[model samples]
Target chain A: MFRNIFVLFAASLFCFASCKKTTPLEFQPGDKGELEVEFDNVIGGVNLQLNTGSYTNASGETFKVSLLNYYISNIKLQNADGTTYTVPRDSSYFLIKEENPSQLITLRDIPAGNYTGISFVLGVDSLKSTAPVAERTGALDPAAAGAGMYWSWNSGYIFLKMEGPSDVATSGDKKFRYHIGGFGGFSTPMFNNIKQISLTAPGTSMAEVRKGKAEAPHIHIMADASKVMNGPMNISIATNTTVMVSPFSVNIANNYVSMFSIDHIHND
Target chain B: MINKKKSIRARLGITIAVIVALVSLGVACTKTSRQERKPMPLVLPSNFPAPIYNLSSNPITVEGFELGRKLFYDTKLSRDGTISCGSCHIQGSAFTHHGHDVSHGIEDRLGVRNSPPIMNLAWSQFFFWDGGVFNLDLQPIAPIENPVEMDEHIPNVIEKLKSDAQYPGLFYKAFGEGDITSSKMLMALSQFMLQCVSAESKYDKVVRKEGAVFSAEEQLGFDVFKAKCASCHSSDLFTDNKFHNNGLVPSMVNDSGRYRITLDPKDFYLFKTPSLRNIMKTAPYMHDGRFLNIDAVLDHYDHGVQVNSTLDTSLNKNGVVGIKLTVADRANLKAFLNTLTDDSFIRNPQLAEQ
Candidate 1:
């Protein structure tokens, strides 16, 4: 009986070892998968339709967004097992436009895991903002991809740009322009509006990135446009129509910090 | 056995020596290849402080500087192809828009401020009167994009260069086989501007004891200048490179100067200190070009300083609003200021637009 029990135990150990080798529940070191973070720009729970959608702010001013663009960079994902995966900084920067259909940031070669949380910077970091011009290619290219999103005079990228027409706007064209950017000054300390955003999947709806999966999990993130004028401080269009590099821009930046939230995760 | 051991040791020594010789030969070959592209030397005057610009990042090369010169003189950079960087910044006027109180850009669009001289820019930490641009590599974009200035988009300029018959080849020679990128273009422009060193003035000669001596009156003027102006125009570069409110009244546009850039209340009406080097050639003086001549500037310092919340403390020493000047002091000071004129720098054929 003792011999039989020992044999069974030895056989079980071998089986366990083989099973661990072949059908491991956790991803191997070299295993990689893809993830898609979709930025859905919305205005007060409604899908934002650029140029036609009318939205009212907390200040009771109705407005229509003509254009909207913002930079999302330095993406990081946290695994359920406490391991963190950082997307390579070079491939991390994304400029999301309201008009662009490609709002889905497809993160390729991400280690297969159950990602529980996501974190990113809303604006270009100071280091990239001041990096040598050659390194600033792709979305960060000032003249080409970036275009009007850069402040040529100020020597920095305008992280978030929202322009629209409002009856209450004091500008002659009845347009309010908010060009928010300042990555702590290069030589001296200045207005730093780079906002860090972190969001966790809601209650067991974590993104399950698998190597052989038919489709990558899509993380739906809602960026509310109304938060620009309604967050923390109620910014009235009549009072401030054009806000660029100003002390008041800090308040606008503060309001927009709470704009992003993970609505759902599609692990199909 | 001892003879065999010695032979082995001799062979090892010869092997090591051969490897060292081969490595040195490879290094020499690389050095020869590097010397194929002649490096244009940046002027480092013995009297001046070390330059603020890092030369290692953008080494001045003959081809790159020539390309920059061509670009500087090219009107294609502007929207209408009528105005170039050289149009506003004339080399004869110490690279300033001479006699224009405020420079006019393409289609005679008047700019609000005076065209600051491009001389001694390598020493400058910030560009323009308001210190808006910190890096020299990023300065050209401002004028290129400003509606009143060149009024041309950078991408368009790059496109134009790519199609140009001569530009692509020139760019290739300068930056080596790459599409005409704005980064390479800007670096090339900097290579030319960095060589615009204005340290060959008579004052420099006198200081260096290069057989040039200040006259008695000029010496007296120097003493007065040392007492009154040298604090702001501190180094041999002739500028502290710091912004200050020199007490000029706000213009019709109500230009807030440094406050516009920093958005700090304390920085109100603060403008960068104009360098005293080639000060005679770069007039009318002041940020707005309100003073037409050196005497007007001196007169302003003597009586026209308007007190404000952010006026420079040096101007308000012991409640005296401005520097006091006597008749002899004015004459001698003028004589000393005149000695700062470096004719060779402004007239250098190498820096001229080809």
Candidate 2:
């Protein structure tokens, strides 16, 4: 009789255990680490000093970057052991600008291990890009990011906004604004733009990305602005000066895809 | 007389019961602590279709609607603080600019087209005479940026709203954020516009069998309307929500209408079919407000249709031009159209500036 009660109690406990929600895999206390991701904007392998006029592109059109900002999201760190740790979506995305290069974008609570490579998506994912304005919070929030990056006419974030004055511009103001955003569709050119970049650590078999260490590893990424309009797909500021939203904008977006490159990593 | 085993079983059962109670209590506490907003239901007449605007994304609340109403009336939205949305859309004239054929903006800047009435907008999938904006949340950007209208940038508007003493608190109450945004501001405006439904007309009561009847001439006019006008202006909302040329002539101006958006030659001269519900009050009709009254509008349909490559086939009556109507038919049609004016909607105290 006692055995019967014990078996029933065990069965109830089993049911309770099975019914509990399965928690997502995340960094344990021992595995917690921090990474400082840096974006260095440049022009022709030189530091891009904003508001400094007269930088010539491959097309020979001289221009100055008045404003430059882009979104980076969906970061993943691949370990040497063939396992990958993805940053949580709620806090992974970041909007970087040339003006605030000092504002370090740090990823905390990353799984600590020897990482072979780092991978991330250049633009905001379609799920987030197409989400209604009210759902956006934190870094993705329109108010937080500033309204300049968003096109109030179209319901999508400008994945990349590079505005400046170009000498070749025929317009009265001699200004050129390249606002690129649209996902991949025949009609909707700005919907499915997911540019995945994977880069391996150099000068070592694998970089030791450790947790609870006094010093965290840093990843420096360089974004070349001159390559944006002149990279394999050559765009002229004289003709295609302004691109807001159209199939033409997609051409500019395709060219900028080749702009990001892993510069170097700093080990402490 | 009971065995010791029975007491042990009772205790075990009580312990299990306590655990279950504790688990449920934890869940209840978490749910309450989150303070999930209770959905504010949008009540509509039984006959109306589901709203095109996705209410789930930006749900309406009492505070949001009130904020929108305040913003709609405030001239601070304009660059010069002289023109408000209410300036062009007066509630007395079914929310349309009554005297102006075409709307005038800031600094007495005249717009190219007339301002349409603002009602039954929840059902509409597109907005503006050219159907430029699809989402209601994004519609306000057009007038705000149109150099002739508000002449204000969105960022400038946000900065202005931030500095205002009362707007920050109002925004906090409506959106749970002390910080103001263009999206939140636009969403609040959309909330107020979504509630402007007109359904209490005398014609509506007659249709619902509520002991009301149309006059003999009005009934005749309604029948004539069923045969002649119901194709484009269908449904109780009185709009097909599709673009049509409608044979508006002297098509000299470079207003390519729907063609401007699509860049298709076939879509040229196509304009959105406006709702004829409040036809009597919102006058100087047509996309350009060329017609002064219903008589001029009917006369255009009768004899003034200019044959164009992009003219809608529905208006083509055996290639003879407009819908041929007799003098009596026009009179009866005018009388029937009058019955559609809902005083309850035009004079709704809820929509008035508070």
Candidate 3:
């Protein structure tokens, strides 16, 4: 039954995708309705593979992972119509890897329209963050989103967290963690990071991701692999290779990368 | 004359029709104004009408409630401290500060509000007498951070708990993860609080019509209570959970009850209707702990209500406002109120400090 439902869903999604554009492109198009976004991770030009690692925690010892999945909400693409095609508040947006389809998510019925740029909040909106728990479920349910991100004991979510092998950690062995969330209190902005990008509208006036564009889709996403690490450069050198592995960070707060910003193209 | 009479009749008919239409429109508008209250789940008893604090986001969790209970009693949760929630809210006095009106904490600092007896808490939409704290999980933070209370931050509390010999194991059993977190801690406290269900009381037994009968004195008190107080302090649950000017001198120092929460003048001197289930044990009554016993309380209520507009209507059924009680009647009323003392829930060792 599950497989049948999956197949049916996949077929419908294909129809939804095809109906939006005349031809298929390597990447999705602007406001491609219900497009399955496969987050195939890469560093520079090579694939990024991560694995579980063991280290001591406050509890003495445990095996954790090199990467963890979380949810991001309030997604929007700035369209030339001056409309924001926000991911419907009722729908979901998750950061599940392509390799983990069972765990990954597919956002459906995304409002079809032309969009200049895409933006999203990195964590669940604050109002929903502090809400109560009703049921308990397994590893990959929306119920688990709260389990992964929320801290009931304190009454907020860990809006941003990056923990991994780091030489610059308080301890010599290379695992460091920074959980940034204080609900935007006097000093803490609930979380440490907010990522934004700028881009030109993808279509003429019609709304849809088109076929065979010479350029990549103008979904302005800003990420700096360099911002996450703090250690001797790629100590493992394989999992950490290609991905920047530096000791400090340079995010938009420290530096900015204007995605699809025309200034990078015409001035030269 | 015939034409004038016809015109008058026509005008009357039009006025009634317009009034009917307006009333229907008003009802529709008012009904739609509030957000759609979610339908109660099957777990909600058939007889119960609807829940007040709509559980829209905070869904009920069987596991989370259990987790909250484990954390409630575990002293390993405190930092540099030998205290757990059970240290203060003991079972005997109905989950209140045992033998004391004010709560004592790590290093012996005193908390302000009389440790209100906890019971039938799920029925209540608000916590604390002042009704300042809206959420139950948020309740622990007041004590944990108050310099006189536990005086611990959530992160430190979790850190301390994570290292404790038994806590990580307990946490893993409750939550899948061995890592203890503040959110997890709050969930666990809620579990214990929900478990502290006082549904099997004599009152409950009576209300459920389960062959429980009242003594003559108790019956008389119940009658007087119903006649005078039950309108505001509605039965089934001992309170309507509404704030009222129960009529004490506004405390010289304390916040003006619900007014402190809303800062509205209309709510001045209003306080949450104190649940009377274990009122006999949780003494030093009133928000500021002004009255010492039921005598003082009844006497105060008998003749003590501040004659302000916000004084709840039940107290002034005849529109003759002000606490009204004859001395003999006061004694009878107190005699009746005493029947609400619940012994089983009070003495349940499972809810005690380990």
Candidate 4:
């Protein structure tokens, strides 16, 4: 009877050790990790080369991009288990330039989990856009980070700027310029072109963010430049050479709203 | 050995005394400089309403105001170093471009709108004719970057200041020792602008019961103004700070005034109701400077009002397009308007570029 009891005790101890080893460690309440989102600018599946790459839009007008810059702000990550993690407002604004060496946005101190989707605003929010000059720093500084991207006359940020030469453009220099921005209005209501973008990672590519990992998960996103002129409303360069601070800019904003998509995710 | 030790001790004592004297001298210099930078008081006029600008964010100081005055007069703010803010906003003309219908800027480039005065701006809620710029801090950027105005980028202006021999030191004295940011520069400009209080006018004295009573003609004009014009120009500041359509025939540009900012059809042909504080000095009048004098403006109100969909109801009362002012009423109104000029404000040497 004693031998049988000892044997049962040893068997129970083995089972406990094996069970602990097999189950994955669940993230604790205060556990945190990092995430990176890369915005890859492309024109119809071809990498965008500034000032040299020639591309034709749906209107059959060929154009060469000289400058492209846009604001991405208010980032929020959707956890796989129905929870959302919002980046702090102060550190959320970012300026994505096509000529910049890095378009990767790294979010630190994110709650460690399996993120299934990401969402962000394509332009500065109306509140921050109208914030006091002291409150506007970093990416929103009208003179520094937002020099060319700001409209000093209108007192708002240019949300997206795309300027280049188009053969069919009607302008004297044959340049198609689209400087789109409007945060409603300060005293009265006007054009609000702030677009919200939400992209979900494709099948089998969930961004797994775990603590103590050697590398953080990277969400690769493709921002198609062709969609700016071709999606929803087909913007012909010959017809609309310069669209800025007008009712027509709303259509351009609407087209660019559908420009982003999740290409893949790497959880290395 | 005793004599050598005494000599060494004597030398050490002398060295310590010299160091103490130098340190005190340095402290004295810094103290005087700091005293010179003492914050200037923004004295609010007894007759004026509470200032619309929040002074706590950017406090006024003697150093800051002086720096701003220098920047206001500095030609480096323009593209070709020819036009300063004072070029268009002349102090003798009550900080307006006197006589000119539309102020000319760098390279003799003409702007679309008239150059407004720079008095009592702390009481103003909006900056430009269309009220596009809401904050005073953001107002300078428009003219500094306007193609027909200064035609220079703010960043480039800052760089020029940085490379200057005196501006960097002046900026340091005004806003501590740091990089001269655009925010600091704008705040300094606002400090000077806020100090431009125009409350010493004859109208203000009469209202304040300061013993300076208005003449009989001025009193009659004041009564007429109260009856006909006080609805729009409705405050101690002589402006309700609201947009309205005064029914002037739209210019050839058909400038859709406030509509450009709001993009609302109801706001078409609407412009800010300008303050009447320096009306006697700040002419040609109206947004485009169409009226050459107060009489022309009165004539426009009396018989020259054009009918428009967005015309102010006060101007078009029951299909009557104009205010129907008699010749005598017009003379008295002009007298009352002249009482709004604050002579001391225009001549304040502190506001002039040194």
Off by over 4 Å in 4: A1-33, A208-216, B1-37
lDDT of each: 0.89, 0.78, 0.54, 0.89
Candidate ranking under DockQ, highest first, comes to: 4, 1, 2, 3
Interface RMSD of 4: 1.0
Summarize candidate 3's per-residue lDDT along A1-268 as a digit string, tens digits: 9998787778657756744543322233343444232333332233434444343332233323365443455666565447776667656446443235443234455555444455655545555543443322122122233333444333444444444554434444555544434333211132323344344433432224434333323232323223233223222322332211111222311222221121111100
TM for candidate 4 is: 0.89
lDDT comparison, 2 vs 3, better candidate: 2
- When 1 and 2 are scored with TM-score, the better candidate is 1
lDDT of 3 by residue, B1-354 (tens): 999999999999999999999999888656643424333221443223354444544444554554566677766556655887778777777777755657778877776667776666656667777665546755676566556766666667767777778777566555553456666676667656755655555555666677877777777777778877786777556778778887667664755666654445677778888777777877777776777777878777767766666766666667676557776667667776666676777876656554
Model 1 interface DockQ: 0.48
Tens-digit per-residue lDDT, A40-136, candidate 1: 9999879999999999999999999999999999999998768989999999999999888778899999998778789999999999998877688
TM-scores of all candidate predictions against the true structure: 0.89, 0.79, 0.56, 0.89
Clashes of each: 0, 7, 30, 0
The share of true interface contacts that also appear in candidate 3 amounts to 0.02
